[model samples]
Target: REIERDALRARLRSHTGSRAELAAQLGISERSLYRKLRSLDRPD
Candidate 1:
């Protein structure tokens, strides 16, 4: 799960778009996206 989340984050960051826009494209809420990113920032 962590690896996949990291990959998804990398793929999203690779493109040029607003976070809100990217979240929408990913079918998630902006808040949820932010939460996911925040969680990903933590060392496992």
Candidate 2:
């Protein structure tokens, strides 16, 4: 799950400009996408 978190963070970091678009393409809600990102940076 942590690896999944990292992957999503990297994707968000590298693809900053197109997040909402990418999130749309990925078939997930923007809020859900952001929640995944928070998980990566949050304290364990």
Candidate 3:
């Protein structure tokens, strides 16, 4: 799950889109995506 999370975070960082749009691409809620990101120890 961590690996997937890292990959998703990386993708989120690289892509040029609103957080809602990126979350949609990953099939997760925008709020959930923010929570996941907040849980991370490092900033992108």
Candidate 4:
């Protein structure tokens, strides 16, 4: 689920839209997106 979320974020980022807009398109709140990104990047 985390990997999928990261890939979704990357795909959204590649589009010609602002981060806010991309988060909207992904159907997640912008704060939630940021939280997810941070969680995914955490070290083991």
Candidate 5:
């Protein structure tokens, strides 16, 4: 999960599009993307 989160963060850093676009590219809703990010920030 940490590796996945790191990859997501890297992708976000390199992506120039809006969050919605990124979410669409990932096949997830914008809200789901935000939720995943928030969860990744929490201690496991």
Candidate 6:
């Protein structure tokens, strides 16, 4: 399943924890989170 970009952005904005922690909360790997963020930066 894919995560929504807006939801990801909202979580990132509100999150005060480290990337690893956020990844754990989202049930994804830290590397996956980074990839998602990177994809969000690119032109769809």
- Per-model TM-score versus the true fold: 0.75, 0.64, 0.74, 0.62, 0.81, 0.90
Question: Which parts of model 3 have CA positions greater than 4 angstroms off?
Answer: 42-44
Candidate 6: tens digits of C-alpha lDDT, residues 4-30: 998999999999999999999999999
Ranking of models by TM-score: 6, 5, 1, 3, 2, 4
Model 4, total clashes? 0
| Model 6 global lDDT (CA atoms, 0 to 1) | 0.92
Pitting candidate 1 against candidate 6, the one with the higher TM-score is 6
What residue pairs are clashing in model 5?
A: none
* Tens digit per residue, CA lDDT, model 2, 1-44: 97877777677667757668868966899898888767777788
Q: Can you give the lDDT of residue 30 in candidate 5?
A: 93
Regions more than 4 Å wrong, model 4: none
- Please identify which of the two predictions, 3 or 4, would achieve the higher lDDT against the true structure: 3
CA RMSD of all predictions: 1.5, 1.8, 3.2, 2.2, 1.1, 2.1
Name the weakest run of 10 consecutive residues (lDDT summed) in model 6: 1-10
- Tens digit per residue, CA lDDT, model 5, 1-44: 88889989898999999999999998999999999989987999
**lDDT for 12 (candidate 5):** 93
Q: Top model by TM-score, which number?
A: 6
Instruction: Write candidate 3's Cα lDDT for 1-44 as tens digits.
Output: 78977797699779898999888998999998888878785655
Error of 6 at 41 (Å): 0.5
- For residue 26, model 3's alpha carbon misses the true position, in angstroms, by 0.3
lDDT (0-100) at residue 23 of candidate 3?
A: 86
